[model samples]
Target: MSGTVALITGASSGIGEAAALSLASRGASVALVARRADRLAELADRIRGEGGVALVVEADVTSQEAAVAAVRRTVDELGRLDTLVNNAGVMLLGPVVDAPVEEWQRMVSVNVLGLLYTAHAALPHLLAAATNGRRKVADMVNVSSVAGRVARNGSGVYNATKHAVGAFSESLRQEVTGRYVRISLVEPGAVSTELADHNRPEILETIRQRFADVERLEADDVADTIAYIVTRPRHVAVNELLVRPTQQQA
Candidate 1:
């Protein structure tokens, strides 16, 4: 990944942070995008301490303009954009009845719209990089969820958003794969991230009990999966990967 530049959104914590560190270790100059500047700075320092290049761009991906600017800044500062990780997302789980409308909006805004905004801004650069950059191939990895594959009680809206991500990733992959731009979807099940921390108290309790018996995955686990996808040879494209804990059934 030396001489290549990768941009990751939602990079302050969890899988995004892990992916940034992993990619940096592999020699890719990383651009870390998130709303938290402090966290981004800390991560960037850590990357630099390891003799890796990192750029911190603070922006909210849910806004189109901010998302576009984030991509532009990465290219302006890092020279090229070879990989984009559209990983900014939220999961708010609850039954439809009496559920907070704000929760649904939040899920859709971050999980779906935010992904779209980042993808839109990064596609042109990714295409150009695929044809002109060192690797000769560009990657776009969308961090979806296992909920994308199966709908469940109390997670209807979350399911819808993730399903939308899968659909968008597949459609975009078909449109760009012929051009050496690979699009991949990573579906993670029961990862120990802050995703579940946003739920209401009742929903949070339900989630805790449901996963009480199962040992969940760590952020680095999914980050490893993403790193594998992007680090593959130009001719190899791992389109969709579903990673679940050994104890997770759904």
Candidate 2:
């Protein structure tokens, strides 16, 4: 991974933040993209202090223009892009009957549409990375959830969005694997992050209580998996990784 460049969206916090630090630790120049400019600058400064390359691009990947600009900025500043982590997402879980329609739109826009916008802009760069050198490799890591794999009550739209992500990852993996571009999905069951805070207060409390007894997977856990995937030899491609806390059954 030395000398390679990776662009991670939603990098101000959660899995995206962890992945940025992990990639930097392994000698990859990282481009951090998120809406919070201050947070992005902080991360970039920290990485630079540690003698790793970092660039901050303030963007909301949900917008197509923002997504395209983010990609172009990474290439303009970093020379080339070798890996893209499509980790920007939102989680809004509520019963379909009474949930706010706006919430559903936000979730779909970020989780499904945002993923597409980012990936659509990044495909050319990723394919270029594959033919760039001896590694003959490039990576696209989509951060999904267990919700994507199993349908459950109270999470219909969230589940649908994640399922779309999984399907896209698989289909694109087939399209580009032989071309040396690897598309992978990291599905996490639960993690102690702000993902739940985006929900209604009562709902958030209820969900948090369910994990009160058992420690959930940390953002760093998923980040570590991402680092491991991109750090492997060119011949190695991890198709998918499912990470759930030992206490999680569903």
Candidate 3:
């Protein structure tokens, strides 16, 4: 991990923040990218205080231009890009019947379009780094969800977005694996993060009660999975990982 640069999106909090700390601790210089500038600055400070290199990139990945700029800035300033964690996403779950169309748009924008934009911008650099960097391989970890596998009544759009992520990751992985750039997917279930807060006020309690009996996973748990995928030996590509709390049956 030393001498490598990793860029993570949705890095202001939750899994993104945890992944940034985890990778930095392991010697990868981290670039924290999210719309929140203040939070990124704070995380950067914490990483630096721990003697780890950190870069704060404040941009909304929903915009293709911002995504491109973020990737370019990371390579220009950090020297090279070896890993990309596409963690920026939003979940606004509700029944498809008369649902807020805006919520569906938001999910598609962040979960699918944003991921595509960032990966497109980072691919060239990742390919270049894989050819000449210290590790001889590059990694792209796309954060997905269990919703990708199971389609519940109330989460149709969310399921669609995550399924798209899963599909895209597999195709991309096949296209790049021979070139030394590994594309992996990490799907998590019922994590205790701000993801649920994005739902409407009336839908919040239902989400909580549905998972009441289950002990949710912490952000660090998923972060550890991301770290494991990228830290594997060059020959070992952990293509996809699905993590769930012990009590989460589905």
Judged by lDDT against the true structure, how good is candidate 2? 0.92
Off by over 4 Å in 2: none
Q: Per-residue lDDT tens digits of candidate 3, residues 1-250?
A: 9999999999999999999999999999999999999999999999999999999999999999999999999999999999999999999988999999999999999999999999999999999999999889999999999998899999999999999999999999989999999999999999999989978887999999999999999999999999999999999999999999999998
| Most accurate candidate by lDDT | 3
TM-score of 3: 0.99
Of 1 and 2, the candidate ranking higher by lDDT: 1
Question: How should the candidates be ordered by lDDT, best one leading?
Answer: 3, 1, 2
Query: Which has the better TM-score: candidate 1, or candidate 2?
Result: 1
**TM-score-best of 2 and 3:** 3
Give Cα distance to truth, residue 72, candidate 3, Å: 0.5
**Whole-model Cα lDDT per candidate?**
0.96, 0.92, 0.96
Q: Give the alpha carbon lDDT tens digit for every residue of 60-117 in model 1.
A: 9989999999999999999999999999989889889998899889889999999999
TM-score of each: 0.99, 0.98, 0.99
Clashes per model (N, Cα, C within 3 A): 0, 0, 0
